[model samples]
Target: MHLKIRHRTEYRYETPVRYSIQELRLTPPQVEGQCVDQWKVSTPIKASTSHDVFGNLCSVFAQESAYTSMMIEAEGEVHTQDAYEFIDAPKAVSPYHLLQQTNLTEPSAEMLEFFAASLPQKNTIEEVLKLAKAVQEAILYFPGQTNFATTAAQSFIMKSGVCQDHAHIMLGLCRASGIPARYVSGYFFAEESPNLASHAWIDFCLDIDKGIWISVDITHACLIDARHIRLAIGRDYYSAAPVKGVRSGGGGEALSASISIAKII
Candidate 1:
């Protein structure tokens, strides 16, 4: 399937900003079944592009002049496969490296207990799906209950969060079980609501030797289909956030984001 994606982020500051630099992982990678037909990032200044350690396309831009607001937009067309599994090619980092847990993805004792009790056997695709279903049921999708920095343990305690939290919780569980899993940031074409286009999921390594992985949408408790567009992969949301930056000024900032994904017929 072909998809057209547009993402725009705006930031308004109560005070003038002096200097700022932003790192973007907005560009999608060309994987086995996914192709980036066209992509671009629009910023106030020229941006330099490079690949990150995880092989994600990175775009960086800095603004030096004082400004009250900043706007960044990315638009593109992509082709995706209807297949559920995604076999990622081995990059500079080894899949085993993902076993190490970050603060955001660390599983709590209760989470480990839940995993042990709920899933006592090996993790086949079906078993993983079962785990995903359990996760969705355990954590009700309650928006505004969590933020970007919320950890898997915290959300598990609350029993509610959005997609990001769901992904983090899944990552924590998989990694704790000795399964290699990574966070995926991307766009989901939700027919029900355009506001739910920006999405997050997980890719657990099915076979490390062959770079085999399966993409699962934890919130939906299912494998990713053509409606999913790949963006970036990382150990946690902080590493794969579409937009992250540091600013010298820009106090009391108000931020807004708009994302749209449409079928290209």
Candidate 2:
């Protein structure tokens, strides 16, 4: 399957920002299951800066904002390829590993406990499916209850959160349980809506006899299909934000982002 994606993020500030710096994981890489035929990144302002997260080095841009409006636009053609072996991506493939490698403090006691419990046991693709089912059954997918910043532990305690929270909780559990898992950010084509919003899920490396890596959407309760288009993969949301940046001014600000996607049948 072939897909075209358009994403736009606009920031309308009540006060002008003096300067801002942003990190973007917006560029999609051509990988085993996907091929990037054409892609481009355009920004109203541009600066080149480099930062090291875990082992991956990313080139970011810094900009000065005198205008009240700031926008970043990306357009591309992505071809869905076939799934391949789960090669061990360098710990640098995602910044999520940086947290563990750098020995950053784990956030919640509940998260730590769950991680500990999963470690001793071996997990399989089947187990992941069962876990996804459990999560779907456990959590209520109410739209308004939680936002992107919500954590997995919070969602687990409340049993309520949007897709982002569900994905994060699953990622943490997989990682803690000794499974190599990462967060995936993308768009899902749903029959109920013509326009698709940004979505989140987990990709885990299964230590089967052949050692395959599989992608699962706990929020959707299925393996990724042609309807899914991946933007970025990381440990969690902080690493895979479609558009992320920092600004010097606009201490108090308002921001909005919207994604529109369609299948070319």
Candidate 3:
């Protein structure tokens, strides 16, 4: 399957920004299960500077205008490729591990207990699938209840959250169980679905002899397919935000974004 994507983000500031620096992780990497035939990003505002942490950036400073718009348009052809063998991406080498090490906090005792019980028993793919499904059934998908900063234990205790929360809870459990897991930020298409939104999920390294990192979307209760377009992978949302930045300005700021995607038949 092939896909084409268009994403646009606009910013209107109440006060003129003296200077701003931003990091973008919008470009999708060509991975084992996906092939990028062609890709490009166009920004209306010429970037003062940019580099690849994974995406493009447009750094601006001292704009005289009070309102500004930053637009990024990307078009690409991506094909579904065959799955690769799952390799042991330990915490030491795994990107997620590196992220966790930098940000340390205490894990809940209840979460630790759950990890102890779940990891040892999940020796087969079927067992892992069952656990993921259980999480889906146990949690309700409510958007406004949780934000990107919400953690796994909190979501588990609340029994409700958006996709990010679900992914975090699931990823934490998998990692605590000694399985290598990472967060996936992506987009999903459901034929003619009007309410398209950014999606999140988890990819866990399989224990089978072949070694595969199978993706499990607890929110959808299914394996990711052609409609899925990956942006970045990390421990959680902070590392994978489509756009992150810092501005040298005081006063309130607001942001708005719009994304559009079309599939070629």
Candidate 4:
């Protein structure tokens, strides 16, 4: 499948910002089953690009002038394979390294016990797929119930969240079960609504013996394929957030974002 994606984010402040610096992980990459045909990034200030630990293309932006608003825009085209078996993914990091949990993704005792009851056997690809499906069925996909700071344990207790929360929950459970898992930030082209394209999923090291990886979308209850465009991989949302920054003097921030995905005929 071939598609075009446009993502835009804007921030408004009651008082103009004095200065700010930000790390942006907004560029998608060309990987197994996906080709970045053409892409561009636009920001309010000049930005520099580099690769992170997971080899994700990232950018650094800074502004010294007082500004009441800020915006970032990304537009791109990708050619994706309908299906792929990930046997050739880069294996630079040890699988065990993924088990180093973060605060937001720390599995609670309750979560572990829930996994014990729900996914008694999660050792094989089939079992993992079942776990993904089970998570989707268990959680309610509702907005306003979660925020950017919500943790996986909290989401587990609430049983309601969006894609980011879903990925964090799956990461916590999979890591607790001794599976090497990473968070994936990407774009999902929906067949129905073109308004929402930003997406999140999980990548677990299914077979360390053969360096095999499986992409799971717990929110969608299925493995990701050509429809998913990979942007970044990290331990949690903070690591892969499209924008993370500190401002010297931006009173209170009001943020608005929009995304659009459409098939390119």
The candidate, 3 or 4, that scores higher on lDDT is 4
lDDT of 3: 0.63
Worst 10 residues of 3 by lDDT: 98-107
* Candidate 4 per-residue C-alpha lDDT over 65-174 given as tens digits, one digit per residue, 9 for 90 to 100: 99999989999899987643455356455667888789989978888887776562555767777878777877898878998789999998999998999899888888
Which segments of model 1 are wrong by more than 4 Å?
none
Candidate 4 accuracy as lDDT: 0.84
Ranking by TM-score: 1, 4, 2, 3
lDDT of each: 0.88, 0.67, 0.63, 0.84
Candidate 2 stretches with Cα past 4 Å from truth are 47-59, 81-85, 89-120, 194-196, 208-212
Each model's TM-score?
0.96, 0.82, 0.78, 0.94
Across 128-232, the per-residue lDDT of candidate 2 in tens digits comes to: 777777677677887777766777777777878877877877776666665767777877756575444678777787653343568888877788776677777
Off by over 4 Å in 3: 44-67, 81-92, 95-107, 111-120, 192-196, 207-212
The digit string of per-residue lDDT tens for model 1 on 162-197 reads 999999999888887788889999999977877669
* RMSD (Å) per prediction: 1.3, 3.9, 4.4, 1.7
Candidate 2 local Cα displacement, residue 63, angstroms: 1.5
